[model samples]
Target: MAESPKRDTRDTTPDPKGRTQDRLIEHSYDGIQEYDNPMPRWWLTTFALTIIFSVLYVLNIGPIGAGKGWIADYEADMKAFAAAHPAPSGNDVSEGALLALVGDQKALAAGKSTFDAYCASCHRQDGGGLIGPSLVDNYWLHGGKITDIYKTVVDGVLAKGMPPWGKSLKPEQLTAVVAYVVSMHGSNPPNPKAPQGELVTP
Candidate 1:
């Protein structure tokens, strides 16, 4: 018996639309065959757009093509926020204001609550020092003046592991805590840490 003639699978012929007709691939397995069809125009366009977008994204380029990039954009946003809501500064509160709070029982109670929640872990409940220096002692690491203490609390000693509470705490809480610390001066809490800084008269 003669072998069957091979089927024509060439894609050279053009269709009525003047586009090459998709032809079946020559090889087949179990009588299964497939055509070499080009992807749809819309799909190809979408794929190309995705590639362009990926390149722009990798370069941190903004929508306008010419921009400061994502990092700069983020920094600008942060600066705007800071300008709109400035961090509490030492100058914002006066020493007399803080001293007045020191004598206020309600303010002192609030301060003690805040201190227990945030500061007790480092300074101990009695302000005798733990990881941080003693608050009850005459020696001051940053300063002894009430205003100086306010600055320290607002700015924080990052090198010494104290966080700037000005950003986290309310303005009232900051002043209250400072007042509470002032009241702790000369407290002579038991087992106080050795004086870390120069002695300052209370």
Candidate 2:
């Protein structure tokens, strides 16, 4: 019979606290000892889960996490919202209806308020020309028709100093303003500024 080689045996088991009872000892020259302790099952499991979750989120390959993720979703939502709430149409006010507002005292008052708030800096409170041409005079740089006035108020003349008041004022407010301007015809102010532009029919 051949001689059997000697084998070293060591017990490896868990303690009551679930920690490994047998620690692997590392050799050191100065007698300072080091042992290898297995990480707790719960901690290892949690660390693995975290790594997996981070990979899934960062890769953007999964169904729910695809594309730009939350940012893409936010953009889609905002675009949908804008499509739902469109801007007011110019057709909301008719030329005939807008013309009717000229005699309306309440409408005129509203128009006057808007004009004072916005137009007074250029046109003056009395409709006499300041930086802008006289609103009271028959002469109009732009045409004098209700449609012409509407376009001017909405789009504005950048070459001149006037800004588009339609953006700041509501459609109804703009209609009222046009009415007030129409009502100003033929009533000359005391110190009327020099007349400018060709005369046109309202």
Candidate 3:
């Protein structure tokens, strides 16, 4: 039978700190001292949970809206919906007179501004021709009535360089401009351009 090891009893007594030698709670091997402090209540709960939740939340919400290009899929679906249901019409005006209101004073002023800005470049300040025909004279390339003039404005003779101003000017404003034009007939300006078309009575 093997002999039992000898026990050291001299160092088994309590130390000067009043704690029992058995309850010292620490034993240093090299240079590190470790205490047995209990885990804090709030730190274990709030801090630990917050860190864990943040990692999970980012994984679920990031990188193209939760997964592989889900945002692109959503945009494509929206475009398809818009194509399926187009925008509705907005204006509530009669087909023909729509252009007549362009003759209104306020509308005429607006049309006049548009006219001066555009037509005046060729027709000159007083409606006499620089390159285009005179607008102030009784002779007209098209008819001279308000409705006829509105048609001429809207459906310009593209064969000639005159662009259809209908898309640019509202019908009411076009009418006002036509009225102003008719009002200028036989104006006999000091520098009237030579007449070209057959004279037509309004």
Candidate 4:
């Protein structure tokens, strides 16, 4: 067989050390030139997070790092939120303003949400007020009325260490809670608290 030609092995490209692969811009006064290299993924993520935190920090502060009654503002906002959200009375809003909140499915749902959050601690999941009063029945310990229950929840009995919730909860939320109580009268649940006060038969 005839001998085959060998490929050229000699290096022809100049040793352009530190030069960009795409070649530097034609003009260069100082020692700066834009690169064609794509930005790294990690760098992009870091920048995005920095922007997000800046926005969050600004919302919680007034200026110069001062919170400026941030807590009070937060509490007020929460109250407004509760009122606007209004407990779902299952769209069953009936009766006058006081009793209107009661018997409504939506209002009951809202009441259930709030009751579980705060009352459940003292009063078991059932209407039985643990360390509190049994809510399963008509208990007149504090006159039972959509208004009475609402007032008690808001004003709270200082003697019982039940601090006023008016500052913590919106009026509508309180109404929803009372609505739930009214709905629970005479209902059965697991391990219901002993019947207390006047057995309010709904």
Looking at model 2, the pairs that clash are none
lDDT of 3 by residue, 90-166 (tens): 43334355445544567567667767877777777677777778887777888766666667876677887888776
lDDT of 2 by residue, 11-118 (tens): 368788987567645444356745566799999999999898788667653455465665566788889976885434664567888888988999999999988888
Worst 10-residue lDDT window for candidate 1 reads 1-10
- Tens digits of per-residue lDDT, candidate 1, 1-202, equal 5645667576878999998877877766668878877799999999999998888877887753655777778899999988986787654487777888999999999999999998999999999999999999889988899999988988889999999888799988988888898898888988998888989986
Q: What TM-score would candidate 3 get against the native? A: 0.47
User: What stretches of model 1 exceed 4 Å from their correct place?
Assistant: 1-78, 89-92
Top candidate on TM-score is 1
Task: Give per-model TM-scores.
Answer: 0.60, 0.55, 0.47, 0.49
What C-alpha lDDT, on a 0 to 100 scale, does residue 12 get in candidate 1?
Answer: 71
Decreasing lDDT order of the candidates: 1, 2, 4, 3
Q: Ten residues in a row with the worst lDDT in model 4?
A: 20-29
Error of 3 at 202 (Å): 3.5
The C-alpha lDDT values of all candidates are 0.86, 0.78, 0.64, 0.69
Question: Model 3, stretches more than 4 Å misplaced?
Answer: 1-104
